[model samples]
Target: MFDHVVFGVSDYAASKAFFLKALEPLGVMLVSEGPLGIELCRPDSQSSLCIRRVEAKATHLHLAFTAESRGQVEAFYRAALEAGGEDNGAPGLRPQYHANYYAAFVIGPDGHNIEAVCHQAEG
Candidate 1:
């Protein structure tokens, strides 16, 4: 629903690195970077996420990525935690949301609730 989302991160380098590792399984790649910030997006998508280096108080944001499959969700969770993200939720079915709402959540360096979810039923 968003063309792109922009936010400021206090630790630009760390945040950028964390996201690069965490979202790799989701096919998100660095689209561009400059002295001030960087942008990332999936190879097959047009939506982008931008993070800027700024002097501001710590803020929290929830960003969810669409995973193509439950395996991708699992891979994303493992990669995210390996990248230094704190586990907010493990990969599993969230029947509360739907029958096949497999997803995972991680706390990013900037304390954002990052999630990857797949809506398709198991094959």
Candidate 2:
């Protein structure tokens, strides 16, 4: 569990756009924004996801957020693509992970592996 997580990126605007689109389907909204960074959170949640501008090496971390349905996962994929995120994996069911395990993966501007997933399929 995280209270908040901040990502350091090369371009603040680009990262902001990527996060906005990818997180839209999850009901995440912009809580705050400035020249330094952008902070987004669920409408009724206190937890925050922050993207800040900085100079650092891109670390490899996979962040998978749950989706209510396969459609939501697919929407995230499309939004991420339109926002300049590189597709790591398309939306699909990975039986190896679980019976449902529908997910989509993308590489954000900071090189972090971002994903949207759902677990609502039968065996």
Cα RMSD (Å) per model?
0.9, 2.0
Candidate 2 at 65: error in angstroms?
1.5
What clash count does candidate 1 reach?
Answer: 0
User: What number of clashing residue pairs does each candidate have, in the order they appear?
Assistant: 0, 0
Q: In candidate 1, what residue range of length 10 has the lowest lDDT sum?
A: 54-63
- Model 1: per-residue Cα lDDT over 4-63, one tens digit each: 999998988889889999889989999999987999998888899999998984588999
TM-score of each: 0.96, 0.88
Q: For candidate 1, give the lDDT of residue 76.
A: 95
Q: Of the candidates shown, which would achieve the greatest TM-score relative to the real structure?
A: 1
Instruction: After the best TM-score superposition of candidate 1, give how far the Cα of residue 14 lies from its true spot, in angstroms.
Output: 0.9
- Residue 39 lDDT in candidate 1: 94
Worst 10 residues of 2 by lDDT: 54-63
Flag regions of model 1 displaced more than 4 Å. Answer: none
